[model samples]
Target chain A: MASEMNDKNDKRGRLENSISKAGNMSGQNQNNPSPGRRKVLKALAGLPVVGLLGLQVLRKTNYDNKHSLQRQLVDELGLSDLMSSVKPVTASEGETLRIGIAGFGVRGGQLAASLGFMEKSEFDKKSAAGSLDAHISQGNLNVAITGICDVFDLHAERGIAVAQHDIFTGGEIAKKHPVKRYMTFHDMLADKNIDAVIISTPDHHHAWMTTDAAKAGKHIYTEKAIIRREEEIEPLYKAVKSSNKVFQAGHQYPQNSVFQQAKEILDRGMLGDVSHLETTTNRNSEEGAWIRHLDSNGKPKPGDKKSIDWKQWLGNSSYVPFSTQRYYSWARYFDYDTGLYGQLFSHEYDAMNQLLGIGIPDTVVATGGQYYYTDFGDIPDVLHTNFEFPDKGYTLTYSANLTSSKFRPRSIYGKDAWMAVGGDLTVTPDGRSEKYGDMIKRGLVNPSAPMIEIKRGALTASAVDAVSSASTRYYEDRGLVSTNIGGRIWDVNHLHLKEWIDCIRNGGTPSANIEKAYEVGVTIAMADISYREKCRTKWDPVQRKIIRL
Target chain B: MVSINNQKWQTGILVALRFLIGWHLLYEGLFKLLHPDWSSLGFLAESKWILSGFAEWIISNSSVLNIVDALNTWGLIAIGLGLILSLFTRIAAFAGTGLLLLYYLMNPPFIGMGHAIPLEGNYLIVNKTLIEAVAMLLFAIFPAAHCYGLDSLINKRKKN
Candidate 1:
């Protein structure tokens, strides 16, 4: 305060004092130099500080340029395409395609949101909260969710509410669609009003619902571990193939921009003679293990015998008494799902398939036990499965544990470099790599850290699951993930659905089409049989069946 | 020049502070300039407190984000050079204070608002950035740069 009071006076006094010291200087005389050399040196003293800062900055820049392995490797390996702009996927504009959603559960809701349907309540909250996550990409495919089929009435109503949301369709004035609920998906399939059906029902219902939906002339987008049992694979395959219906098996990873980059890295052989792929699922929470009947507050979630049609939910699976355990966490039971295989391993397998294009494995050996979560479902809390692709000399190892939410990244081991891919992609040059030997020896590529790293959203809309993940649920438990579905950014799941919708309208093969679905289906069946039956299962491609050994 | 010899220590301290702050901000700007991939999105994404809404508005728009990013880098560089060189020191000091205040507000050390992004020092609304901003305001009040600043030479030819 004291300094401020005399600020103007001090400035005037100092200026006059300096001019008086100069003795011959005047304020208007711009050409006048200082009277003394010492005074002149004081005025020019800022140059030294500028010099020091410049020197330090140059040193730092040199250090960074020297250690930048990513730049060197990308340039050398011709893998710069990984960092190139995301290849544009054509979202063909067309007439609105009416669709029915089966099973409006957790994944069902996610799929619907990805398909550009946000429940009014959720939209209000998500837009308010994650309104800044621009990666959500605001535009929607010209599609409408007119039908919702769920065994649980609450879920059906929720689905109906979501289907009726019209704000996100370019934020236009509310365009109301007559959304109806079907007690069973079969009824939804029978409706001529529905052009496609999204089968997000529990794993047991997938094969039948997808086959039925296809046979009924409705395009199908069914979620992963498409068929829980070995027998359903052929029928599901034949139905989709014979019906000529656009069957997009439920997987959204391929739509990720990073996935394309990862694929390019593999195609360019940046990894160099990849022999093994390691995928992992780690979770410490009950919800992560599919013990989701109870809410976060330890309260039982909404559902009951009266509201949920148990018989219809059971479907072809053997009748089980009304239990919230089966209804909420059906993935934990052998009757409905292959537990980890259906829930999480399917994503790992799908990611591996999409990256390597390695189809059905020759032999799959599964081993693990219910070492944790003893009070709950029959599925193992710790599981490990291996798929040997003899023809490609490739092996896939999937290790999952429900008790530890540690960051166990999924890695693909190649002779040159091993790539760890998740929410971000990192390709660490192997110390003993044959292909990168010269580079590592010359210190061009560092062996200690990844030479090539593609951070999510670096290329384009990196919406998790659609963007990057191991996937997101098991990746980083922090706010590195978001559930918002609004923005000008490309959401991967939205792109996958758009691809399905486009294929339906324009007739092109979507990445998650029937053939890939069949490969994944057989692989899941083999792993399931190997886990449950305590045997090693081998795929006989000629016979189109897995032979137990 | 009358008080120059008498207030040498005080003026020296003021000049040293000016140079140090200039060096710090200049390095920050230079680092961002060097790392082409560096974006304020990470910092803004984890933004908390009063400026978070403004941060979101910038983040949601890529062009706006780019503009903000470039301005932040260049603004820091220009202010830093100004402070060190004592060239337009008052404008630089005031601008520096505003920029520091933005940093302080975006991730203010207020309780419950400081945990999103891990920071270097702990503070109770008195972090180093806030201190720096106050110090910068001091420069706006005082002509410390006149002791050995390029502004002193220019001021010799004009009114304050």
Candidate 2:
């Protein structure tokens, strides 16, 4: 313990020294022109040439062959027509599911808004509230926000307002459905009127709330990285299973059209025997890096701490002084959250994992430090984690740099071809595919052609406006419903909530169900362990515990 | 000194050339990658020599432009790093030569076909780009830079 304290002291001292040195170096670099500085300047000067060359190559590559290859493969699999007509599988019209929002925070509000409560002005002009109105009018899978709970009075009030349709732009607004506000989640769970709960509380509170809700015979739609620790995962999953209640983890990518198409393309085995998958989370703003919304003075506004039940908000965690920064941006504190692993990489892992159905990795090796966002956060600004799944014959890489957004679209590299997924799905064939000369001659594959790019959804100015300033665009883009359904845009959050609510009403499983959530939870837990312990983390299937290497 | 199997002085000269050309190419690629707004439009647009029409057409087409941009950026970086690090030195030199040759042929510092971009040095149908391509060609022929690079380390491991 003494040595650990000493080590901590040493790290703090080193951090201070480095921060000062970095400041000094910036001013000193121009005059002294150190080797590193010179090298960087030279590299910077050559950028235009390289960018031009890169652009030219991208333009010149003939994608005709690759497109033909995809067409042939997709046609063979009878997915050619389905690819164009792909839509979120709507749940059969059923009785309304009564949803009790346990955590009325940002994500909780977004989820509620997505459930047809968002201010219509926030909706895209073309999308028309993400086509949620039509879905709500369909009456099947309709969700009535019966209860809203939050320790913070402000959050609770805001949630109740949105649910009651008092904060929206609808034509008529005489509260037909008055949503009840609860001070504690337990009260909401006890309300027999509530059929389900959407757990969007801080990372620390997820486990207990989800398990408790399950035990209460209520379905759950929880946020991503459902729990903070590995120990909580099994019990949480089991509780839902034992209760026989629908528990959907909030990983919204499964509702995305591009991802759906990518999955379809992968299912066709077009990207033959995928060996490598790379995903990235990058943003270049304070808001993007979990700094939370700040006031004009650049300091977080201390909320009504007197009104907020701070003790309950802390839950199992140790007590700390009331700080709005901690309450709002809980992601910045290790005591409350799993940092980037749970917040960002969990989404990336779930997206790729959903596409491939590859479970927890054999080993996780991560190296990162709080290099940039050192203001109040313990989480690293830059993180790179590699997961090796030898059994699956593939390696997954997750990299993020809050400092820069230069990485290309995340992709799956396979023997036959590589496919990238972002705003669109693009598949490029490898040169080795030329070995199938007959296929080329038969017009099934184009050896020298460029890649096949499929634009799955349209972008909306409103969508960008809604998210870009919030720094949640990174989160939105990764798993949000960016796909069009029946020529109308779908809200991924809405789709995810609908999936949960639908499953609650009808007997079906959600895409981000408990089983899938466990895999994602364990993977993220491994990443957190690897980063925190500064060691290679491996999962022992036999013991179901993290082993250090 | 002129022996085909081994010549210390000749090898030294080639290694220097390899490193220099590699550094140039690698530096150019890295710069472009780091710059967000960097594009090949001006370079491709100002093509006044042979293949100018083709270059202009490539610029006009969005898909083709994107493809060319990616290829030019990555190809230069790949070839540049390869030459600099002496990892796959011959292949790197060859690829660099090809890129340089294309640039030369596309604009061909030929007399009377004045480029929109200002030239650094005067040339009689041969400019700095052509000269560098020639150097890259020579570097490709004498592949001895691996003696001090990552390739050498790999070779040693294989031998061991």
Candidate 3:
């Protein structure tokens, strides 16, 4: 730290010397303007009046040219307010909420074990090489898991084991209050003991389960891409609203710290008038592309299919030949998921929405097709979306490639400065601001010199790190969870779950509620439709539905 | 240095310098004013100088920005014409110097602040802006329009 300060001081000295040297050579310093030069400036200031009078005579020309310059720059640039703050709703101490786990998939497993059900030290034993140790926080939630449900017995058993503290790990485990395993979501919902149900199932199952849970008078936390079809949206929304249950969408990016800071940055206008924003989600490797892993023998776990209720797992999707790959890697298929739109693009969209609050786009044009990872899925592996909100005078461009892990950190561009919003928010002012005139005149701020880079989080820039490739780690670095809290790591998922619990107790909605998800749902649906139909899509505010353009 | 033989040459050189700089400024202003798409945004945005914050502020706010853009576009034309035709040459020269000073300050060719732009000539603190500003200062101090330019024509008419 001391050395860095010294380096800064040295650079400052050199800059000061350079500028002064230039001033001396110019025969005048900033302290004094030559007498004749000063006199000329006084006379020239009157030219504004003359120009104004001339403008009045050429009113048509003035009017025509008025928007031509300023408007074009802003429009071409797509500037808008980016950082808008939303206060997170916290829970108050009340009745111990009985929660039910649904789906028991990758997302469900993570959520259940992560909610203080699985011990951090025990979970750390299963961590991949170089992964940080999870934090052990006591006095977190006073909630109880009453029931667990999943079509797959393996997932349901695992979720139940974690919730009931039945899982055996390397360390000594303690017994916790048992949670009953429900073979069906309906059975779980039927139990009056379960006050809330966290539906982390496949994309297709989200709508029905959520609506069912809501109708059953249970608070809901459903995963992203909340509904696949347009038909499912209204019913689910009505169900949640009519039942007056707190419905939290599983778009957890809002819980991240960088997004929260982004709101503050936009509020401060530190980046100047934001014009454009670009976000990219890139992933490489077969595993990264939602390919299911095999057991130690490099084969599907023995009798995996036999343990799962295949008919129930298929849900509303058309039935086909039973395959373990289809059940495990359901994300890669269109019948169950919108592929990139549901899995990745939804994340980017919601994160931007959280920061800018631009909501739905005025128009969206989807591009790209199944480029890489083409063998398995009908969905596009590489997708690009250009969302234009003309009234707001900004454009949002989202592009993702599953073939390459080189992700471009999301950024907001302003007239004066541009900022990168990712795991850590970095704000760098545009070099051309007139505020730097004196420094430039002195040659202190070299035109070709590297910018004064400012960063908040330890993550240098949004680059793909193989070890940190897990979605949870990405969210953690992005401020969804605590990277390290006194040597213990915390997950934002836990925080999000805690928030929902708190809100449930206090009779409020979580930060990411149903209403915001509905808006995002429309946009995501439009993106998918636009991609598949090969057309532009428009959102009709009056109709509250997507209109194909 | 102002001997009878050298006086005419000096006056002629000064007048030529005045005309050349004036023409450049005038053309720049007129071209910008005529081109509807022309904006100072890029220049301001691309500014790598010390006053970058001020330049950014100017571009960020639309109202202040429009005024600045208009003032700059018209100011250049006014100063150019004033110098070339010898109408208020003193004020024009001073205005021209001030403008150059602003440009120089915004993108100084200092040791550390080497602009990414490819400069035509080697400069040590004294670039084109400085040279033009110094020349304009000289024009302000010595009114030479009486010798050849329109100011002299006006002076002769006044005498008549």
Best by the DockQ measure: 1
Better of 1 and 2 by DockQ: 1
How high is the DockQ of candidate 1? 0.36
Residue lDDT tens for model 3, A247-305 = 88877766655566567767766566767988777777666678774554668743355
Ranking according to lDDT, highest score first: 1, 2, 3
Q: Chain A TM-scores, one per candidate?
A: 0.86, 0.79, 0.75
The local lDDT score (0 to 100) that residue A141 gets in candidate 3 is 67
Model 3 chain A lDDT-worst window of ten: A457-466
Q: What TM-score fits each model?
A: 0.83, 0.63, 0.60
**DockQ (CA atoms), all models:** 0.36, 0.02, 0.02
What lDDT is reached at residue A294 by model 1? 86
TM-score of 1: 0.83
For model 2, the superposed segments whose C-alpha errors exceed 4 Å read A1-79, A82-85, A88-92, A119-141, A166-175, A296-299, A434-450, A465-467, A470-472, A476-481, B1-160
How far is A192's C-alpha from truth in model 1 (Å)? 1.9
**Mind listing the fnat for each candidate?**
0.42, 0.00, 0.00
Docking class of 1: acceptable
Model 1 alpha-carbon drift over 4 Å, by segment:
A1-70, A130-136, A171-175, A458-472, A475-488, B1-20, B30-36, B43-71, B85-88, B94-138, B147-160
